[model samples]
Target: MSRNVREAVWSPDREQIRNMKMYRLMEKNGIADYDEFFQRSVGDAAWFWEEVTKDLGLEWFRPYRQVLDRSDGAPWPKWFVEGKINAAHNCLDRFVKDPRARNRLAVIWEGDDGEVRKRTYRELWTEVNAFARGLKQLGVGRGDRIAIYLPMVVENVVAMLAAARIGAIFTPCFSGYGAEAVATRLKDCKAKVLVTADGFLRRGKTIPMKEEADKAADLSPCVEKVVVVRRLNRKDCPLNEERDIDWDVLMSNRKALSAEATDADTPFMIIYTSGTTGRPKGTVHIHSGFPVKAAFDAGYSMDVGVGDTLFWMTDMGWMMGPWMVFGSLMNGATMVLFEGTPDYPEPDRVWMIVDTHGVTHLGVSPTAIRALMKFGDRWLEGHDLDTLRVFGSTGEPWNPEPWSWLFEKVGKKKVPIWNYSGGTEISGGILSSNLMKPIVPCSFNGPMPGMDADVVDEEGHPVRGEVGELVVRQPWVGMTRGFWEDPGRYENTYWSRWPNLWVHGDWVQVDDEGYWFITGRSDDTLKIAGKRLGPAEVESILVDHPSVVEAATIGVPDPDKGEAAVCFTVLKPGVAGDENLKRELVTSVAEKMGKALKPKEIHFVSDLPKTRNGKILRRAIKAAYTGKDAGDLSSLENPGAVEAVQQSSAN
Candidate 1:
């Protein structure tokens, strides 16, 4: 265990950094050091993005005269003004002309049922063109909304690229989302076409995706056409004769169509946030904005290239899914798509996939590492992960335990674990670890080159060593224009708190060394006896105990102190939730966090409620314990865990 805990520095060679696109661009512009170069880039973002776009050779039909048009306001800034380009052309069409990339595998997908599918660049081009024509045939024109509800299958990628090909906006719903959640996004966007699959396998069972799609379509009156794929030849596949059509039948014997020419700022997608409270906000992204932003993150931040096969464990609905797919393809890199849960069949599936596929870059969540660590290091030692070059993670804050496990067990203490922190509003990462920088255990080295990210108190004053709200001082290319319909809600959610500054919900701390650490969401920070602490600090200590599998801490009301910390824990499979064991766990936390910071009550449950993408929902547990409504359980992958928590807290 001690071997797993140490700081690692993975610095690239001077020649390697010199060959990178960012470094070459910086050299061309006479910039030398990373800090000075980044300062100049954000100091004048218009010129920086313009240079990067041209450096990356983004194919455009018509170019723009001006770089940025901030006529409206900073919040509504327009990027690459008057430029005409299609995201599909930049991602697929341009690759077709290059012989090296034309036949390379664009996507490699694996299903839970041992089914594997592969597509090359040429093949992906044909399918995307055919699907774009199919969408046109179904009356989907430019600016039309198309919603896709499918698993991580090839069709999911096809649907997204096809929608962007024809200049239509697409919304992707999580496969695990219930009907109401699906209905809300589709209805809000007023989707004209819905692409869904009959079913997909999950935990050795089939989930009727088409059935849920049907339920959502029934509630969404704007849906004019339903396209269903035959994932499972089940007898009960829903068929609406009037509006529904077969996916394979529509694409049979059809010729590929030409790509659409669209303005750079044309609307591309409307993704909803998986927030714990209230209705999910619909964030609007543009073609030039998100694709360009994602490409920058991949090329510069993650150092992914054509020779790399990048795989990030994500679903179609989350922001990272679209971010990875579009970013990897635009860079002419191969992408790996898994259609099953990571821990199904066995716990070492993550390591197995890297070994089998020879993936060069991998991304996962800290929540997943914590769950996998409980199965022991033997599972990790079974596979050879020498192929992995870079390790990346997001979704939640990392604990030293799981972060160390990932660094030592799988990464062999050699690969750099780049910690990225961002949200759906920003297309990619705001804070990221660069190849040139030495990574701390669980810290972001600095803000990504183009973002003016900072930590500030309630008064909007800069602070160090103390937790504060994370904010972006300047607008970037990928900042969402606004919410779907309600400008007031969008403004209130982000800009209302501070003047001209975008208020990110997370609370972060910048240590004396200038390394940034996000505590958690500001709302989730526990304030006990006037001393505030991030739940991650408490949960990290609890998860360090060998018997604990996962933990979530929240501040509940108390008579003596203003608030008291209460922890909900999920034990290992064989570990019993006896009083003796509970007492020892409480004492352990006290020894680590001091007596005042110790949890007032400790409850053990069979599991912790988390989203399909594996984000522990502390707010949901608190709501369930206090008899408040758990708002919007659409992203809840395991409602049974919430029920377990409720029952245990009551006892």
Candidate 2:
């Protein structure tokens, strides 16, 4: 085992271990060993999920006849068979029954310019019911699609629940997506209504969201009605009298709409995730599937519970937004939504929010941490974050330096950072840090309980102590039903690689100590001189230098080698990108990763293109540098970064 894997940075004490939901579940089931319980979870999905839902106190209008039915296949397995449930009912209605729970804070929101908003469970339920009635007044019904295109606000969550309450499917587009990108999703789902804001604040600037919503609605002829949130109250806010309605006007009806009793397999959400070579693929998530699984992961893995606050810096379009919402609400914990960049106004904005909100479980991306780390530890000095118990990280692989910085500085070497890995299609994490297990820097304890995950060679055989393909051998409750209107594409994307095995596109490594590390996306892997390389591996080496803030590596066409590695780096402020520094970085990688894997060249730029959730757009970077088509840039948070990359290539 490597030195990092051998040395565990964090471990749970007896009290911490006893308090964990996973440990309690094991004890309740008479299982003394965690590894044994994990094996049984995968060995018997039915028993495991039954115990989990029972533990969650899940109530069903109609009880499930069976736990799982895989007669069709692994990809199409039906969970909680014959059960009738509603997502909004579980998320809101059940909590309202208890007088104490009803008044507890459920959603805490922060705007770009430091404005704050808080909604109790009762208040959130009231808004949801009103919006449900509004959606019904517009003639929306079960299975009807609603496209939500708005910033991170309380209204976005309201729109989602209201759609679910009425049995309508809602798809969220990134708040920063352009008109064309928004229109594409509207067209694909043939949405009946669009929920948007007039405008919202971002970095102290007013973004006219209604203008893009209007343009997108113009292109999507299927959109029959548009609901405007009047967030900015702009005087020039255009409205089509025939099809547009103001949110306050529509919500004039304060009556509650009865929740529909949807079957377990009934689809409630269709989240569209962008692929490398095609239009976004809509991943279908069901009532019982996503909510139940996400809640389980949050409670069992992260140890979230009642009265706790869980905050993830994310947008509604990203999977983590919904993941945070469902997980926190279902677990009776408060969820925090932020509408601006973590570093906006000041470098300490994120830490300030956590301290102000009393956040117990905080989630952030490595890229965001790397950016904040440049501001140094001074920004974090004044914040009192004693309430923080754990940190959640996702979106991309972590570099050890940033991981250590977050662990040592922000966490005060007390809180553990849970490295979470999953995709939109999976609903929640395939791999996550368990509170019961010791944490290695930037390494997952193992697969999330019941994942049945393994690292495998090309022939589907298991491999350890080396990097290989990440695969899951069994279907869990959270697997996507299929891509919307594209079952063939879904099967081809995941299942065609191996029989009854899901080839999750991430390249992973399992050390001898059983700690797991995600390298990067398999599609993003670079091959130089017949050797495979994960960009994160090279990026980690480059970022180890004090001058480099971030780095991305890509393979380009080569005459001798099959492909050669080309690197782009974003430097710390005022650092000179001289030839000497470039040579130093090259030698650093060559010494650590060996000479054959050395980067052919390195270009320093102002920024790296990233999604709203802070995942580096390495594909876009490669495309811009090589003069190729950069497919599906709608998820990009900064389009100018791509232009900067192109300019660098020219220079």
Candidate 3:
């Protein structure tokens, strides 16, 4: 299969032809061009969003009379106020009623042990209904919070939908999170029920998730029951007869449950963002408009249609899970869910899943691509990837080498790389590259259909050719209502920078061609000798070096300079990290971004600390280097990365 895929790799020109077809589709859909859409989006934000929501077939119990109510100011802009709808209805019920979709595949789960599980929309609806009934039997109700601590299995998805079905706000904790992290979110949300699995497989090893849930339950007084799904047959799994319930037993006795009728503004989910400076903020997304916006962006921007199978490398804990599930299902598309590391068994495990399932749209992170690129094209030599139509990237800025490699090798340059940017607060992408736009490495084409995004200077004036903070001028459907139980914090965090505009915290620049480049986080901007520099600009130059696999730059306090640049780098596999390679990397950054922005210290590390969603935590690195406590290490995929950095700092 790998050989077949290698042979089918088309030249650059052939790839261009494929992209042209995607552009034609956009034109057919009334977006004359990417630029036209961008102009209309900023000029007529409300109208543009209304059109997108309607086109996505979002059915509201009470349709919105107005698209937005911004008279209250940007900080308090009310969206779809008069509308009433349920997110679960938009994601599941709609598909259940459609005959063609009823028999169509909803989720294709691939276990780490090579076991495959399939669920059709009809079957998925039944399971979700039963789960909802079980929650009700346990005294869970609307406005209540349910914490889910499970792996990437079908049950996790079912638990989420079931919670939404009954108007219970769901909060998912990454199965990899330790007991402390899980307990923090549980206490914050006052979760009444905790959903977990007995165990799960990771890299062919068993992880006892139920034990972690048990520990969390011990600390959280709000938890009334622990629902455990039997994933691995552990002989001595612990269970309390009073509070623990077997997942199968509960579902077997419950009947199909009806969807709860709720207001559009009702809280749907609380997704915690990896807060590097303090406690992780529980970003609250609501029902109705949030699902509609996700569906619209995935369908129109990524060109996902009914019959297409979408697969994104993500876990149940991340916002991408909700984004992928709701967007694909609401659009009547199938989703491929994998329950193991991308490079588990072999370097080509992801490609195998793609070919085996005939996945059409595959979303991944830049970190994953960088890792795959190090393995070279040989890993993907012969896989049948003709089914793939679009490639999506999110989480962080991608370098040109990995981007071009992904385009030329995996996509054969035929698929458009949809670069997306948004946080868990928004539920989905605010800015993204559309199929019709010209391809650029690590750049977004424009904002989503309705988003009014702009790159502005510190004084709030628009900047076209220089790097500045990214802000949205108007409110959109998927914007978060507030932080869970912390409306004051939400106001101060998001809306404080600009009066009503949302300061996205991303430092970005838009070229004269209108191609948007994200430099890094606004907080990561370094002031070296009074000159401001973004970490992404420096990291991009470092990654351009052949020996460098990935790099992260952070500003550390300096005696001479107000802040000096410190770079942490990871070399390609088999390449040893040495002083010579570090010198080359530092020199390369000086040549690209200027000597003033060059790193004062370049240290080699095995890996950089990152969230599960694949964002490098620069603030964490800064804290470690400055001999300060690293806050909120909960979302880190590799906790060892922090110790590695600390060891390097001591040296």
Candidate 4:
């Protein structure tokens, strides 16, 4: 642990604390202490979630008889039992009911070629209703699955809301995925319909997405219809007369449809997250479960509310993409959906979007920051980001250098970077930074409200001041109901670890000051010379080198030490990756992390495999280097990187 990160750099003033929604929630509960508020939230979850739903103004056709039902078991505890609610209603109908909110912008979309589109709550409601009616016309209804494979656009959001409007479960595939990946999800969900765009632009090139969608639809025999959104307006766009239907034609009926009066526990989404070894796990989310948790985290923790524009650089498939949608709309905030890379056209595109959209809360991945930082601060010159109030980060652990650069340079040391950490199963964040407290660099101040999170040893005993497994003791509202049609795997994956304990698979530590930091995935832990190690520790030290832009570390089998560390690095542009540079990098990590943890080998690569959301695929890299089967690579944004790692090992 770095001593420099021990002291908090940013603290909320009296005025700032008073303005925070977290403070208001605490005040409303008559709790003077923030810590006390968290205690009550986890100690009495039923009371806390009841207040959360009431505070969020979540609409319910029939109120829940109880806040939580745990008789089944800890892993499968039902939330908001007996309540009739609709996700679309909470996101749109409630806002449209108020005249003042009806005219507010619900979604602001920016295309790759400088095209812009905006929709108010009333306008979005009309579009969503039209699509919902169209889905109903296709015989889609409650319990049916609709697969969405479209770029980041207003229509993607509309499709999601439309599916929810009719009580259909929707599964979103990464826009960058190929046919096999998309087909896997479609087949797993056994979707009745597939929504996709003709194509999309990226880095001045038109990617033919329809072809992939067509191939995937062909593979997924259960797909009864294909709805194509004419994004690029291609005259040559092929349409299978038997199965494909134009989006506009499908929406010929512009009549409105009522939001489905769904039971709160009814599954609305089946989001698949890639696992280390099998097919992707389909994490099931419900109407009140994901929406409520996302709303509370955004509204209370991130301080998003009416008039705040929230933009996260992500694809529709990732949890954060859906999280941004439900969280922002549910809070009456505008969601900014951009359809291009952050560095495309210019490295400043991300900053430009923030300035152009008046974004108050901006979220990004640490990998993106590391990639953007290579361009220097010249890209951020003219954009006046005066409207940005908070910076949100997730996806992976942050190295100190990029974290400091984001805080000190981009934020001008004024805005707080809330390091948010969680999985798709958690709906939002397990650990999040609170505006009411001071923040340490790259560290979460505490767990999100109602998360009974703790760091535990191998035996399940709580451990502090050292790295350990991150576990949640009590069931939270956002917990995934279970893996779709695979309850046994879900139970074995999380609950079987230690009775009712949910082992989240991440290595975490709480320092003496009570600040939390995730080291890396517990399964990816590098055991060297009888010492437990985290890949982030080695990667952080390697990235500190000026020549190295990004790095990934993994443990390989060793005859003597049991396991040895191997490093893969992507050097800065124009930097040579000769043996001398590799030696220097190896020495640098050795000097910083002691000689025992020195990388046995360092290989230079152009890029590392990552998810659409920009999380480095360390397990994939290890699998490739070891010539092991890399299972379920559907989430990888760059399959070519795997071959590169494999080639490097052969060298």
Which one is best on lDDT? 4
How far does residue 603 in candidate 4 sit from its true spot (Å)?
1.1
lDDT per residue as tens, model 3, 1-651: 000011222223534434543344445457755567567766876776776666667778787777778886676666676787788777777777888778999899999988999999889899999898888889999999999999899998899999999999999888889888999999999999999888999999988888888999999999999998899967789988989998987697456677887776788899887665678899888886567677877877787768899999998788888888888888888998889988889999999999999999999999898888887799897889999988989999877778779988898877778889987877787788766545666777767767888889989999887788899887777888788888898999888877877988988877776778788888888888987677877787788787788889989888888898899999877898888887888787777667876789999899999877678888788888888876788888887898899999899
Count of clashes, each model: 0, 0, 10, 0
**Candidate 2 lDDT over residue span 1-651, tens digit each:** 112335898998989988888898999999989999999999998899899999988889999999999999988999988899999999899999998799999999999988899999989999999999999989999999999998999999999999998899999989999999999999998999999999999889999999899999999999999999988889998878998999998788878677999999999999999988889899999999999889998888988889799999999999998899899999999999998888889999999999999999999999999999998899999899999999999999988889999999999899999999999999889999878888998889889888899999878999997789999998898899999999999999999999999999999988888888888899888778887788888998889899999999888988888888899999999999999999999998898888998899999999999998999988999999999887888999999999999999899
TM-score of each: 0.97, 0.98, 0.94, 0.99
**In candidate 1, where is summed lDDT lowest over 10 consecutive residues?**
1-10
Better model by lDDT: candidate 1 vs candidate 4: 4
lDDT of 1 at 506: 88
lDDT, residue 547, model 3? 78
Model 3 poorest 10 in a row by lDDT? 1-10
Give the clashing pairs for model 4: none
Deviating ranges (above 4 Å) for candidate 1: 1-16
Q: How far is 15's C-alpha from truth in model 4 (Å)?
A: 1.0
Clashing pairs in 3: 1-382, 1-383, 2-381, 2-382, 2-383, 3-382, 5-382, 5-383, 6-381, 74-500
For candidate 1, write residues 1-651 as lDDT tens digits.
Answer: 011233444567787678777787788889878889999878998988988788778988898878888888767888888889998889998889888779988999988866788999999988888888889889999999999999999999999999999999999888888889999999888999999999998878998888889899999999999999888777888689998999987676457677788998898999998656678889999988898899989877888888889999989898999998987998889999998877888988878888888899999999888878877888877688988989989988888888878887778778889888897899998998877767888888879988998889879999888888899998798889899987888888888888889898888888777878888888888888777788888887888888888888888898877889899998888888899988888898788777887889999988888887778888888888888877777888888998998899889
Instruction: Identify the runs in model 3 with alpha carbons over 4 angstroms from their true place.
Output: 1-34
> Candidate 3 or 4, higher lDDT?
4
Q: What is the lDDT of residue 595 in candidate 1?
A: 88
